[model samples]
Target: MLHAFRLAAVICAVLPCAALAHPHVFVDVSLTLRYDAQGRLAGIDEVWAYDELYSLLMLTEAGVEGTVDPGQMAALRGLDANWDPLNGGRLTVEPPDGPAVLAQPRHLSTQWQGNRMVTRRRHALSPPVAGDGPVFVRVYDPTYYVDFAMPSQVVIQGRAGCQASLQSGQTRGQDDAYAATLRAALAQELDRAGPDDVQVDIGAVGADSIAVSCGR
Candidate 1:
């Protein structure tokens, strides 16, 4: 599974001027905010469902066919086990009062859902975040190579009086149609090559976020 991104990089190098902009893969993300007995933020549980095309590619790489069994699935764990520290496992968790920290991903399990692959993982926050303020979360690839579709709702366990809501980072106050158009444009820009000295700011344009808050 880790080879998937490496394969994409190879493809990118081979085709520099192609329309292969960002987002070669799409993922559906579901998040759960976990709390400890003291009602403090403990960690995050995530379930990532890959798109049909990506899933097929993964299975092919693993030499798997048809619906995979438990044993086969077990062999396919740690897809992102070796993740780039810069990307922080492609997940951003910002505590209200302190600086955000990158988390290492621990692979839980994997399963086959139709043609897609559904995998689970957990990120433990050391010292756990304790506050009633909002804790913002985002799932994104800094290089914009993968697009993550954030869930509409977040599940909160081990805590009461807590609420989670989806907040658009860049597309806030924008219509759906316009937001889609903007994201498409950004992809083209990301694919475009320019002077080496020039740096393109990866603005949180299309990055989706989930904000959670407990108590008043």
Candidate 2:
């Protein structure tokens, strides 16, 4: 059982970029899987998420246990619920090379452990094998059958980094189709950003870049 950690602040820290044109509006997260010298996956630890909100929601919240429609969505911004605003929702990312429609949801839960509130959630990994490329997640809304998507990659300019795609509004609104095109095209612009590199201003059209670091 992996535990989710909450930083000691509410601020969404952003990395600065010089340019801001045609940026991917979303966040990216790094799931660092460590193995022993014998190559037995020891544990999945310390996932650094880069504002890839939609991906996380699909994997963690929607619970990709069975059949998930190609379109689904859950609005969780400052949602009023049982726990804190942040923990009330979830995040999900698909395996590399998988279709844009298949996605696993991740939900966050806060537990009362002694005097403090602890946050924990199952990452619900898909294709647990290491080096298994990335997968596409279907961003959709349950109430409605519409789906949305962010281009697979949006290059950050300052340092030359790659970030995942996330979109708002579960429905295919006026501009959703265009956003989806970017999500799929981003993968071609550059390779995945290394595990620890941070991508900010995901919504910024430009002004982002990654030096290209490995996720682990």
lDDT of each: 0.68, 0.28
Model 1 stretches with alpha carbons more than 4 Å out? 1-21, 86-89, 171-205
C-alpha TM-score for every candidate: 0.72, 0.23
Q: Please identify model 2 stretches exceeding 4 Å from their true place.
A: 1-90, 99-118, 132-216
Q: Clashes per prediction?
A: 0, 64
Q: How many backbone clashes does candidate 1 have?
A: 0
Please state the error at residue 50 of candidate 2 in Å. 16
Candidate 1, residue 175: CA error in Å?
18
Tens-digit per-residue lDDT, 1-216, candidate 1: 223333444555565423344556788999988899988888889988888998888888888876688889865664542266443227778886764654677877789988888988888888788847588888876545567889999888999999889987653322332234334444444665632222222324557888888994
The digit string of per-residue lDDT tens for model 2 on 120-156 reads 3333343342322332233222111122233334322
Give the candidate number with the greatest lDDT.
1
